[model samples]
Target: MTVPLSRPAIPVLEAGMPAPDFTLQATPDQNITLSELRGAPVVIAFYPADWSPVCGDELGLFNAALAELRRLGAQLIAISVDSAWSHTAYATQRKLHFPLLSDFEPKGEVARSYGVYRAKEGVCERALFVLDGNGIVRWAYVSPITVNPGVDGILGALEQMNNSTQQDTP
Candidate 1:
């Protein structure tokens, strides 16, 4: 008798909707959760896998602008289907300062919850979500599997969000 494979359900996050909060183990066994960064804006980038060409470039952009993102009062977390061990190796290999999370258990729980996981391949598509201080999704971008999300576009969106917030304050 052969057992059938089951596909994971994907959760779609709409614009202006509250992002689901989760706590995952980061490198060095540190816990990183969305709620912990609620006072500041956040950019949650979901990628297919580490060490891939486009993913490498996308992450490199974040790595290179770590200080700039902090200056913008934004924190970043990159999630993937790879194991924490894989993330550790990748982080060390790239010398990344930000946490690269593992959504390996339950096999892409976070990715599926974020609606980026590709069930057949057991991998996530390239997706980006910008959440404001209140945890509302301000902007979202999901790239085709073969395409790379432009870094400038994401930066521009963050700038717009910052400007909007500034205008709202009395």
Candidate 2:
């Protein structure tokens, strides 16, 4: 018989909280601001680092999902504590078209604000936040650091939000 294992749960920021606005380095010369991407759904992926094996596969999966995500009027912006240069190299190697914002310098400050920082590991816990066009968080999830958490939950949130917006339209 296999014994069941359990891990401590990490809390995720609750849905309906106003996503704290932030501007972070996206490239050597460019910065991305959360508020600037309004008028479309935004998927914020807070992962641990740039080159971890799981992180690479997780982001690669999102890269593959970009078309579907865009069709729903959603943009994917991944945030990690890695520096801009590191992010650039990682994105190049991974062929990721989405912006990978750096939470470097202060290191995990944005992750802390979102309640996803893993101080012991000096990285952000695996977390996902789906914000509506107006910048209110619609759904959130915290996954084990070694887990990917996939894109189904995000796709569900985008579909639900899109449907609601349609219903609200005249």
Candidate 3:
């Protein structure tokens, strides 16, 4: 009998590490550079695809939580191996107000840099990275592909980051 091997477990980013910066297509016409958003909190949601059921639920939750995320000084961006065209269609269909970045072409390079790319599956493992204004990761979590990790964790991390940042300032 032949045995099939499971994919290697991908690692999640650790808190206090500087985030990896990348320029990615956010729409059919626009591109965004991660480092350009410095001086503001940024939340990166890396998922597998555009139209998958779990992805839809997760992205929609972020969409609904947009105001709360903004109030906490966090800007959310959804990244996937999906193409810019795919992201554009998916975002429009879901009325997602946030940018959906395409990790296509070089495909998963950014995700791999963050240690969230699944090589065997050719997709980004469902993961979250919340970075503070200084671009240091405040929190991160990688969930099962079938699960939605929820916004509470992200919000809590944002609060903690805010407290720490305030303490560091005059």
Candidate 4:
């Protein structure tokens, strides 16, 4: 009898790594491509599902921080293995200003690329990545599944990036 081999785990991408680009549906008629937003900093958030208590609060915190995030020149996008319709409803109900992308259909394909896919649970692990204007990841974090990882770290990372950019400007 042959024993089946389990696939090796894919480690999450870290700082100094180039972010993998992909286009995901934001709405039924609209698609958001990561590469298209290359000239500005980006905050990529991966959550397990839409409408879950923790996710709602996590995104709500981000929503409240939209002004600050934008002031730092970072466009925030939260992704999950939920359908576009589900995301639409959830965003509308939550009054979210940032885009919530659907990683459904192919089901967590983007999450897998980011190494945040929870294959056994059919969802995404809560993860965050801050990328510079050139699409190089500047900070990355993966929080436990049940914890509500707040925006403090995100704010710090954006602030650091903002300062670095200003210093680099001639």
Using TM-score, give the best candidate's number: 4
lDDT of 1 by residue, 1-170 (tens): 97653333655586889998988768647768889889888999988898898888889888998887888888989999887888999989988889998887888887877777888888887889989998998888888776778666667778999898899999
Separate clash counts for every candidate: 0, 0, 0, 0
Q: Write the per-residue lDDT of candidate 2 for residues 39-124, one digit (tens) a residue.
A: 89999999989999999989999999999999999999999999999999999999999999999979887888888887766888
lDDT of 3 by residue, 1-170 (tens): 96552332555678989998899999888999999999999999999999999999999999999999999889999899999999998999999999999999798999988988888779998999999878888898988888999899999999888887789899
Runs with alpha carbons beyond 4 Å of true place in candidate 3 = 1-10
How do these models rank on lDDT, best leading? 4, 2, 3, 1
Which runs in model 2 stand beyond 4 Å of their true positions?
A: 1-11
Per-residue lDDT for 147 in model 1? 79
Candidates 2 and 3: which is better by lDDT?
2
TM-score of 2: 0.92
Model 4, residue 103: distance off in Å is: 0.5
- Please state the error at residue 115 of candidate 2 in Å: 0.6
> What residue pairs are clashing in model 2?
none
Candidate 1 runs further than 4 Å off: 1-11
Q: After superposition, how far is residue 23 of candidate 2 from its true place, in Å?
A: 0.7
- Greater TM-score among 1 and 4 belongs to 4
